[model samples]
Target: MTVDVEDYFQVSAFEEHISRGSWDDLPCRVEQNVDRILEIFSDQGVKATFFYLGWVARRYPELVRRTRDEGHEIASHGWSHIRATEQTQEAFRQDVSRTKALLEDVTGDPVQGYRAASYSIGRNNLWALDVLQETGYRYSSSIYPIRHDLYGMPEAPRFAFYPVEGDLLEVPVTTLELAGQKFPCGGGGYFRLFPYHLSRWAIQRINQAEGQPAVFYFHPWEIDPDQPRQQNIGLKTRVRHYLNLKRTESRLKLLLKDFHWDRMDRVFLEPAPSP
Candidate 1:
């Protein structure tokens, strides 16, 4: 699962209390909070991976063609949310090649995946994963291997490897290791600061004790608890952007009925056939 389509005043903890030239005079609730997260992932059938934000897809091109005609998986959260360590590799290769050609010209498909605005491509800009595999992009949940004062790398590798030198795939976002440490059980703001049964027992111990598969993420202004709230920020960014914003859509419908989710290019760039 994933979402980060952006716009709680384009949050990078409200980029110094909101102001990318006042983000189009504020008050644009990411198209009614991504149409209530596409009606809670179509009432829990689940199929996510919506990294969006080429300035909210050039102002919601029919909410990215109704989240790609309701099946979901558009990907690419660059172009205006900056921070791939504040860009420079030719401005992060022209912000992921003009947000992957404006989200493949608004959903004609083929926009693989990318997610770096705020997971900021750590360890001194990992060449932004070779400019996301030389701008074709295959995978990148954008590294959040736990160690944060606003983004992490913490010596990377907590899952899906291949940091570079070929077939993309950086993955990272779900961490749970216990006694050896590494804590963030994926999903933004520690899935609203933990306690949804300890993030369903740390995603059922990363799926039955480390068999893997757990990326997870969240954003479309994190279930919009009456959004518009960023004045003079700092009580730890106002309790990490308003703590459990009205219990994040009932803990995301109990994390989509507690597990089995897809669409990071069909659980990491397709090809699971001939079973």
Candidate 2:
């Protein structure tokens, strides 16, 4: 899955320096990076679900059309890259509604799924699920089952399940408890930072041992090492966002070759309706 189809300046860490009002003046980095991704996927004949930021969609309607033309699923990544937990219920509702409207306008397809910025729907903010359902989203891939400083639901179910009174399907990032600690087998920086062999093994183990399909995610920025860098952010956040970026495309190609991957929607079918 993808999030925030935007230039590097839109990332959460750099939000202070970059304002959304001035997005048009900045370079079209996401467009170039996404082109590279498209070429890579074309080489392998792989299709994916791209969760687009409404901001990106409004700015680059052609990119959204091209993604659909090339056979990728179009979904919402909210209008701005703002975290749902940070917004009031009314604000979150509007954020999602506006994004969904904009994405549908560009793709001419109903956007049934969403992923929050930073995967921000957690224990306290899970009320966003009901908001999503009310706003017409049927599925969400926003929860991260593993614990993290920004977002995680450590005790949440590892696989897809219907939360109480909610119609949305929850698909957390794939992770495994190795020696009793959560490991990042699901990709992103973890895929680049760790030995490639280890990621391959972890995915194999998850599939063969547990019979669960692994969910992998990467962003356009992840592959754009030459993109402008954000300075003065905390070291850990910067590293998490930028480390191994230069090698991301190559590593993605290797991972694609090593594993049998399908769009997340294909692997996990729609959940049953509640009684």
**TM-scores for all predictions:** 0.32, 0.93
Q: Which digits, one per residue and each the tens of the lDDT, describe model 2 over residues 1-275?
A: 34346668877767777787877787878988888888888788888888889888887899899988988888889988998888999999999999999989887888888889988988998889999999998789888888777788888877777874856788777888878777667877787788788888888898899987787888888889888776677887788888888788888899888877666566665334333
lDDT of 2 at 10: 79
Which stretches of model 1 miss by more than 4 angstroms?
Answer: 3-47, 51-66, 71-73, 77-88, 95-97, 107-120, 126-141, 146-152, 155-172, 183-200, 204-255, 259-275
Q: 1-275 in candidate 1: lDDT tens per residue?
A: 88888878777877876779878887798898899889988988998888998988988888998988988889898878878877689988998899899889888888988888888888887887888898898888888888888888777879887877888777778889878789888777778988799888888889898887888888878788887776777798889888998998899899899887988888766763111
Give the Cα error of residue 261 in candidate 1, in Å: 9.2
Local accuracy by lDDT, each model? 0.84, 0.81
- Clash number for each model: 1, 0
Top TM-score hit: 2
How far in Å is the alpha carbon of 267 misplaced in model 1? 21
Candidate 1 TM-score, true structure as reference: 0.32
Question: What is the C-alpha RMSD, rounded to one decimal, of candidate 1?
Answer: 17.8
